[model samples]
Target: MRFTRRKSTLWRTFESRYYVMTLLTPLGLLGLIGILVLIIIYIIRPNFQQKVVSSTYVWKLSLKYRKKRLPTSKLRDLLLIICQILVLASCAFIIAKPACIVKSTETNSETVIIIDSSASMLMSSNGKTRFERAVEAAGTKAGEVLDGGGEVTVITAGPKAEYLCEKETKENKESVLREIKGLWNDNQNDIKCTYGSDDIDGAMTLCADTVADNPKANVFIYTDATYVNGSVPEGVNVIDVKGEEESNAAIINATVTQDQNNYVFSADVIRYGTENTPLSLKASFYGVNDKSGENGKLTFELKDIPVVANETYRITFRKDVEYTDEDKLRGYKLVEESKLVLCKLVADTDVTTDEEYGVYSFEQVMFDIAESDAFDFDNHYFIYGGKKEKLKVLYVTTPIDKNGKGEENPFVPAALSIAKNYFSSRLDIEVDTVMSDKQYLLTGYNMYIFEGLKPDSMPVDGVTFLINPPKGDYKEYGFDLGLEITSKGSEGDTLSSNSSNKLLDGLKAEDITVSKATSLKNFTGSDDSPYNYESLLELNGSTVAIARNCKENQTVVMSFSTHYSNIAYGHIAVLMTNIIDYYFPATVSGTKLEVGGKIEINARGASVIARESGFTQEEFTLTEFPATLVLTRPGQYVISQTTYFGQDLTDTIYVSIPQSESALTEERYSLENPFTERDDSDYFNDLLVYLAAALVALLFVEWWLHSRESM
Candidate 1:
């Protein structure tokens, strides 16, 4: 079988001997002039001049003595001349670098080389990164293909796969090499491997055209990635440039949860390769808004934690002080709390382990084996989800009766308070509660909650929440309510809620009982409807609870009073929280994302400015809601924007390297051979070395012959 492998063109050409022998540097043939000089010397070589010898008898004796050996002598003389001529020719050929041209099936075959420039390629060994090695190998392969009179294409698999060069031939091999080498900066500090995880599939797709154009084209990929028990595309070759062995420690993930008076900080730490690796974990909290008499910064550490390879160890930290289960569930009640949490694996030299406020727990012991931990990018993690801004809320309820009693449902106010405490880290909530008889203005509040009362005009300035809205014609709110319907039995009617509704995210409305409800009218699902509404709660095929949104305002109407439903028992708080989340979503949807990950930006302002830790500020205009923001690098980004209501809000997003990239010894599949149908033939071998050896042997033989003749 003639497997079309990339053999050196010169070697293959000479080995196959399909074509006649040739000289690489024909100018060296000038050495052949030595043969002409030798021949000329033989012609002018002084013919035996007839001279009167002093002794004819001696000459005659010598002639007779030589006659016996004349035949041998003549043969020797002829042999010597032939050897001299051959030696001169050998010298010429050696200088010319003689090579045989043998036909090889791969001569005209194209080669496509893909270089993986992912973040994991930044692994360094012997001062050279994997990307550097891959680039070098790619260049060498390209040169070989070009020298064989075949075209070469170079592609890079980074965040996106793209071609570095296409159809490069020997004529422009140098330029192609230059382009590949340009992936690294002069200092080698900045490389094209800034992107996480390679897009190998994309890169291979780029080779499709070349393969189509040349059916015999060979595709090769140089990367540090490995696939475990996985096979790559058929007919492609994968060259793994991984180091001998590598060990890495990564803080793969981190998050904070409110635990009563203290916060619980947890992180996933992993050691890629190395058994019983001893490492320290450090947790630092900045801008922590807590109820603890103290504030500012809090740090905790776990020292000499032996982490096993390939295992994820979850470490959790909380207040050193003790608390109850209730406190644990509620999280420490804090006057103020902002947790800009940072978790990192301490390097070998940093030995400080602080267990002051909280101790840490290592949940698992994972083990795998690798040699070096040179890639340090994934060691640190940041959690900035705890920081929040201010949100103003206004609550209006019915006035007091003659007995100094109010007709208000206390459940609404209670749910609001619960939501305020639950989202304390993300929002500083200020609530103003007033009786319906008092003068209440809704223009300044971020949210307005009204219960058991109807205003002359609907509030259009903020998110409107009408609890047990009374029957009325509310043209300003775009929808009106029908007469209140009373249930016939005390058991009340079980309502079914739209589980898909964002406002009912965690509530089970089917279990709730409502004895009375008002039906909503004119909420048809139509483009021409005055309000863009979504039914949240339904009873007997009628929408009892509704949510609507527009550019000018947002409204949520619950037709049933809290007193008439089982919702006040416990579901009210959860429903309120979901409502707040849906309307006032965070500026950035997620707290953490992988490098090259895209995040949704739902800015309340006209524009948003994102500033990453080590990058320039990026500004995006909010032409619409939920804009896409692509994070290309690993860092903490602060997104800031001012809402239309003049409320300045800021959020933090952490971009990290893909966890897969830290697995230094991940199993990878090799590229399959796409040229199965191609002729498999041995390439021509180079004849330069053999010719030099022959030349040396000829020289030695000529010297021996000359020495014998002299004797």
Candidate 2:
């Protein structure tokens, strides 16, 4: 009468057979589903009681079979049930196991990719930067996260932790992907750095804090493994781009110590991995003699070390090179086979005197760590053991600095006087009335001054003291023409005819000679301005100076001549001594730090690094050693030291401890066992899920029919 048949009769539930026959317990969800099915069927097809009667005796005869209606109805039901079973069975054969795949209502996640943009990542891996590989990997992870309803944040590392993107969405996938794909790998040249401190630790730590309120964030660190381990923050997941299966050979360390006679060529060659790699190690030195003759000389051969995975190879110069002024000032050189040499200069007092060596220093006299409690500790024994047991000083005539046209600049005097007057007691102060000749900072003092140089030619290392970078230095590149003075000569050198004096054409100083001063700064009469000659460090002029941390823990710098005024000179000794003292981080308790030890240095007050293994503090004078104590060894060591700020201000370092195995001197390591995986997919649930989808469709249809009837 309805002109239609029950489509339910033909509909099939593909996985019903297994659900009914399987010996496994029905899942709780399935039980609930069964209950729902019963309710739906009862509601959709409820039968009412019926009364049937014959109109007359004849009618009763015709309706004789009416008494069997109940049985007939029951029989009909049995047939329908049987037909349904057959249909479901047939469907089950076609689609064996069905599953009820449901959408998860859980929280979406966020991923932060911190790529290592440091120059070190420039090394080629399959012709691409390890940085590129890291970005690719991060992108992949980002895709997964996006697919899962999550977001991505990109952070980069170099001189600064570069935030390339913040919380990009799937909707912006094209732009985000393009941005990353277009990125070029940045190399770690150890040059082109804008800041003295490449605070990767601080960068990541900031990122972690940025996402602190976001519980869904996971930070991925993509790097070449340059950071000292302990410095890693706890909250973020580190995704080291240098894969666990990393095979790398590097010149990790090199040392060169010399004066005017000996030129030493020393190096530390290292190969590390889970597998062995062939390494051709050679050491060579290249320099120009006084005659300007090219001298490419000497080679130190290293015995091939057949090392196991995660091992190192070390080779030192058997014969130390003769000491030369250049060697101490220029630093050491590390040469890799088939690669250019990476060199670092050392300072060992090039300008020597009967009383003491020339010492120049710069001070961060106003620093934030002036309130640390670790100053009283005894962990400075390392400083006491070396040739640096006592402070050294150099004495010279007046007027520490000058400007072009032989005028006094306020900047130089202020910079030098600050370190000399305030930090005198703890330092081996040196005073040089005039600048010297020689390219090295070690030639005369533990520090050098750069107040007079062109601002644009700022050295890669060294503290720059000023409101502006020098004329030729990067700060003022186009404004004036200033030549980058090579480290070869001192401040008093005569200006070369070929040199451009336009940078200093209008420059003049009270006590300096014009010919001797070719560097200058211009000012527009701003009372509080640093470049303004008035009120500049009590000298009514501008000055320049530098302080840097270099080889074997030395911070060599230069102080421009304008800083040599009597207003500054009287305090030079104290400033110099204090700066030198500041170089030695004040001692904390526990004088001797043991190998594989935890030495906490609580730095209180202003401090800066001086020559090798030295640190000075206004309130405390002690030394702070580099991470791992010995660069040769590998281990987890923490310099739990901190400034008073309770910000983990101390350098927390975890050195990768050396294994005799690294030297391939002990025993070789072999893989003890193969890897295995455990599987956990629910084969039953998968089938059930598919079946549930069909059931859901059927349920919707039945509910619609019931609602129509109710209306």
Candidate 3:
């Protein structure tokens, strides 16, 4: 063997034998100091006794010694000394602590498995879904890894990539297998795959991070995905779990629109992996507000609809439509949509098509493919088109004159009339006026406006506006009004406004002048209270207009009268419009969203509850206005909440799957591994016992040679 002073060496005992020797403890080589001591001992000469009659006696003794000693005897004596030196060297080498370095093999390694859990994985073949097959494959791979004294990690690539098991060894093999099997829904049919798109990049990133410390770790991805050209990395292995080609026809999208006096239903159907297959669509509508027994829940089917593979075919269902030649070419069909029947029958009964009857129309419609395809989940879809609730406003004012003609503020009424048109497209607004002394109810209104008067208590559900509140103690509403302060001159006092406040968005504070303004004090201080206050308009550093908002209700108090302002004619309308817009915002900006789409939700009640039929249910507390909601699955979601007034408010929205996930035969994306390969796989084995054996053999040989010389 060749020994080196550095990290390792080569040890060879025979012509074909080979071993890579590594020094585990190089400090042990200090034992070689014994070689120097042995040399010093051999070099020193022993003292001899002095004699007088030596020459003749010495000559005779030397002659006798020479006659008895053969030439080979000296060679034996030299060999004995060499054997002793070799024995000493063997002890030094044993103390050096050498070992053999060998490369690691598959018996011990680290492995990571990534499973695709997207909607496309729900595709079934022979009653077994692709997700199930992927789980089985992952479990097999994990079992093999654990049996070989290796560690295994399993991660699922769903809407969000997460770990199923991390760094599991043979000791916990049973628990790891149980977790892998839990992915399949054996007992219940709850969805096993995510309805949203797969996070392939995120899964790969997690895998890369996991194997960062182990360069020789094995990574396997079990999915039906086919990578692009040269996309798969060198060390990773992707097992495609897809079987034979399967044909699928799906109703990808559906919508409902209002025509002149009827409703029109439209749907887009698409086929995958099949050419020119005859398809049919069936639709069922459930009437929610049809008081007239004329329109029951109806179902209709259109057969032999022509659709091309991978091409969207749009179908329309309407009543009393003359089919033009162009319409025939565009694939328009004449079917009695159920919503049209409900609306037409109700109109025949001579009922007004206002808020009372609008809600009684179709709430939800179920559309399905007549012939079942390989993938059943995409075969059906739902459309929710419920009517929105109207916003009701109650305005109560005191008369300045004895006549009832001055029953309400003319400026405030005019401003509300203008707001009715501005918010016409978003909400249906209704205004009711009443005298403060006359009988009026404080419940069941979205907004309460009081002028020159204060109610006993504010409504619990909706917002409230107090314009020029009369001097009184209003601790019931959590505030008190003090004596009024009039301006010294006819020019009046200039108002100071908060520019950052959204209530004063368009109104200019410098131009406004108030002849008299009341002092406001002693309101609740905590932000959680319903009377949480922020000054919007201030006169001489005292608040004249303030805005309060909390979870229970929202309020706006304007202490100054509009009649005293120099520009009250035009400015009052603008100020009133801003208050209406800020207090009563739309609940949902959009009613239709696709998977992975986000929409803003303005809570009108204590919280917002979003629920889909049998799939998803989530609740978000109404901490602030305009919270964000993300649509992770496709279904008919009903967004509802309970106001503090014990009224249940609801709105329906539709979420649909993206068009990209419909093509099961096509590969969506590819992944690449970023990890590096290990260059060195060497280990060490101790050789101290072998060196000790060699020392014993050397000592025995040295004794035999010494005995021969003595004889």
Location of the lowest summed lDDT over 10 successive residues in candidate 2: 362-371
In model 2, the runs with Cα more than 4 Å from the true position are 1-109, 116-124, 144-150, 157-159, 185-213, 217-246, 274-279, 287-711
Which candidate number would show the highest TM-score if scored against the true structure?
Answer: 3
Q: 130-160 in candidate 1: lDDT tens per residue?
A: 8888888887888888888888889899879
Candidate 3: pairs in clash: 289-360
lDDT of 3 by residue, 1-711 (tens): 998754333423431232466666677777777777877887895758555454697878876876588677778867877877787777767777787666433444999999988877777777787888999999999999999999999999987899988999999999999999889886434545776778878888889878866778888988877887778887788888876766788877777776553566777778887577867777776764543243646666666666567777766655544556754554344333321111112222335654222223565678899675667767887776544357889999988765655545688888988888777555668999988889888888888999888788777767889988987777766677866778997978888876487788888888888888897876657766555677777777777887777656578888877777764678888877888778766677777777888878886566777777553454445456578888777777777777655667777777777666666755644575748454433344567788888888888888788777656
Q: Please, what is the TM-score per model?
A: 0.61, 0.30, 0.67
Which ten contiguous residues of candidate 1 have the minimum total lDDT? 359-368
lDDT of 2 by residue, 208-280 (tens): 5446446546777765554343544444555555433334455444333333333333344445444564444
lDDT of 2: 0.39
Candidate with better TM-score, 1 vs 3? 3
CA lDDT of each prediction against the hidden true structure: 0.72, 0.39, 0.74
Q: Candidate 1, after superposition: displacement of residue 294 in Å?
A: 11
